[model samples]
Target: MGDNDHSHPFFLHHSDHPNLVLVSKKLNGDNYTTWARGIHISLSVKNKLGFITGDIEEPSSSEDPDTHAAWRCCNDMILSWLLHSLKPELVESVLFSTTAQAVWDDLCERFSQSNIPRIFQLNRELATISQGTSFVSAYFTRLKGLWDELASYNEHCTCSYGAKNDRQ
Candidate 1:
């Protein structure tokens, strides 16, 4: 397929496989924020984010047979990648999910907590964190990781504060 044609969601690189682990760290009941972020980046790079976001719907079997087969192939591939990225214990929970989105939503509901208590805990950790016996790089990495997770819990203002007021 041509470059433009191959950009479709159904298109998979020869190297792509169901057993591929999208992230170095598997989801182990904790570290969902970082793990999910890593998976999003990897899937986005593969042009498969839509599978988890429900943007790419499966074609009907009656629709063109080729199209239906292609969609099922891509869906199963994405599902396998998601399963491979989770810890063995966690995999059993999501193993039966038919779609990548179903597995994603299930995991998200189980681990994606952004409540006041969580935010306060992160802030407290940030305040007490120190280089201590750890190397400078390790300290910085830990601090940065906490900061990123906290930032993800925050909601950004969509209103344009810099825009000129019509009444002005």
Candidate 2:
């Protein structure tokens, strides 16, 4: 997706994390399931997957000052990255968040709704596709775009090797 390069730094904000692209704008949205999967993998890379899963808690002020500071820095960095990656309208909602997990949870709760109808609609369109009068290459490209978008909505096993195999 086009936004992948932008979201990379946020997930890799931690000095220890690997440098790699995450979700791009085209693959991120309420319309599909790819966003969640991409976020999961990104967080995993940073060893901060617990933030979204709620397995980890924000460090309290009463905790060790150094540990608390580090946690806050990491959370703030992640929140900043997420805020930067979102559309302007979406940014307003999570802009005030102090914890990265809070923003992630809010987004998930807001968009993770049943999308059965959208899936069916995409399927119907895919079924009706035809080369018609268009050149074969053009038709194939259009069909592949639809298939890629459809695949984004339906998460499946992703190959970790090769650019073409790595659908995420």
- List the RMSD of every prediction in angstroms: 8.0, 9.8
The best candidate by TM-score is 1
What TM-score, over all chains together, does every model reach? 0.74, 0.57
Instruction: Give candidate 2 misplaced runs (Cα > 4 Å).
Output: 1-21, 26-29, 119-168
Compared with the true structure, what per-residue lDDT tens digits does model 1 show for residues 2-23?
Answer: 4346688889888888788799
Off by more than 4 A, model 1: 1-4, 114-117, 125-147, 154-168
Most accurate candidate by lDDT = 1
In Å, residue 101's CA in model 1 sits off its true spot by: 0.6
Q: Rate the local accuracy (lDDT) of all candidates.
A: 0.77, 0.60
Q: Which tens-of-lDDT digit does each residue in 20-61 have in candidate 2?
A: 335665223554356666667766776666655556667677
Question: Residue 140 CA error for candidate 1 (Å)?
Answer: 10
